[model samples]
Target: MAWALLLLGGLFEVGFTTCLRFVDGFRNVPWTIGFLVSVTLSMGLLEVASRSIPMGTAYAVWGGIGALGTVLVGIWWFGEPGTPVRILLILALVACIAGLKLTAGH
Candidate 1:
């Protein structure tokens, strides 16, 4: 359950980050609102998940998911470069995130 919440929260983190890309420094009203809402929901879910999950594990996983999601979205949706090395590093990060989850007692 906590991991599930962490996943959801991390997804929201991705949402907020992607929205940030489109916000135009908070000047674009709709995107700004999306950013604000996503950030709020992400943080709220993180806090809730922390209650049952170890803080370090939860945080690391959340951040990893957010980073992974952001990178994928950037490459797929924003025309960011997706070089071989970059993709390999992203996969390594996924492995590390999985390691953390497997070792975490939660």
Candidate 2:
């Protein structure tokens, strides 16, 4: 359950970060609202997940997922650079997150 919450939190983190790009320096009201809502919901879920997971592990997984998802979204949706090294780095981070989760046994 906590892991599910953490994953959901990470998803929200990706949503908020992507919305931030659309905010156009905070000029777009609707995108800004979306960003704010995403941030709030992400943080709330993270807090809940923290109850059962260690802070370091949970935060690393959360941030790792968010970073990886955001980068993929940027590449596929926004035409951002998708260098091989960048992809490998993201993969490594994801592996680390999975290792931590698996080792934690929760």
TM-score of 2: 0.94
Best by lDDT: 1
Q: Which stretches of candidate 2 lie over 4 Å from their true place?
A: none
Clashes of each: 0, 0
Query: What is the RMSD, in Å, between candidate 1 and the native fold over all Cα?
Result: 0.8
lDDT of 2 by residue, 1-106 (tens): 9999999999999999999999999999999999999999999999999999998888999998899899999999999899999888888988999999998765
Can you tell me which runs of candidate 1 are displaced by over 4 Å? none
Best model per TM-score: 1
Taken over the whole model, the C-alpha lDDT of each candidate is 0.94, 0.93
lDDT of 2 at 74: 94
Error of 2 at 84 (Å): 1.7
